[model samples]
Target: MTALHWKLVIDAADPHAQADFWARALGYTVEDNGAFIERLLAAGHAPAELTVEAHGRRAWRDLAAVRHPDDPYEEATGIGHGRRLLFQRVPEAKTAKNRLHIDVHAGPARDRAAEVARLESLGASVLRDVDEPGGRWTVMADPEGNEFCVQ
Candidate 1:
């Protein structure tokens, strides 16, 4: 059996902002698809309206992504082959709790509160702190209202 490669896709009102937030939060790098976009445009395979100038280069207007710094990626398309998160723009806003959420663990010897504070500074908000028998953790919401845990 072989393991499959996959990336988590998130729906957001602004994909670029979400990508920036997540990249900073996770210590990841934003994928730069400018070269591929330029090639597409030159080949007349894609319209210019689908792209916008971002980070001083071209990017998809409705999509953005972040990938772990250590992960392998394709140089041509700037697409990560492992540990990636893709954000796509949607017409509507988030209306309810997320069924699936990300859990951020404070690495060894790191302070959870400090991490939470750092995340807050990055536009995340603390929803609540939980001290359950199972474990203690902080629940937080991202800029787009996506819930995640900090432990």
Candidate 2:
């Protein structure tokens, strides 16, 4: 058997903004590496030029992450050690459709329409509504235009 630890990586123009949107969408929490960054700077092990102010706090200029709300994390760095998605800044914009995407299951007990509406309020736009022989779902795009489905 093999052991593996993984997190999805997404490229974005603004990693912090992407992290914020995904955190709200998935009910996740954004990782706060401020303390660890400060420690690194204080010890002269890191460059201050690699840091930025985000969400009114210090954060890595090019990277941010969001993790499942129930997952465990490091206290000092606030970096999630469990299920998470990491966003990194890139020079190029998303120029095409996403080859990989997320499917959000609001479930039968949950109001999918209301959920969609809520997501819309959180900077997601509806791409399309689907009602097919297989099942019904809505295709939506995040603030940065990454496509995801709500089912």
Best-fitting candidate, scored by lDDT: 1
Query: For model 2, how many clashes?
Result: 0
Candidate 1: tens digits of C-alpha lDDT, residues 1-151 = 8999999999999999999999999999999999999999999999999999999999999999999999999999999999999999999999999999999999778999999999999999999999999999999999999999999
**Alpha-carbon runs more than 4 Å astray in model 1:** none
- Model 2 pairs in collision: none
Q: Give the C-alpha miss distance for residue 121 in model 2, angstroms.
A: 0.6
**Alpha carbon lDDT of residue 24, candidate 1?**
96
- Candidate 2 lDDT over 55-144, as tens digits, reads 778899999999998988989888887899999999998999999999999987989999899999999999999999999999999999
Worst 10 residues of 1 by lDDT: 100-109
Q: Candidate 1 — which pairs collide?
A: none
Error of 2 at 94 (Å): 0.7
Clash count, one per candidate: 0, 0
Candidate 1 has an lDDT of 0.97
Clashes of 1: 0
Cα lDDT of all candidates, in order? Answer: 0.97, 0.93
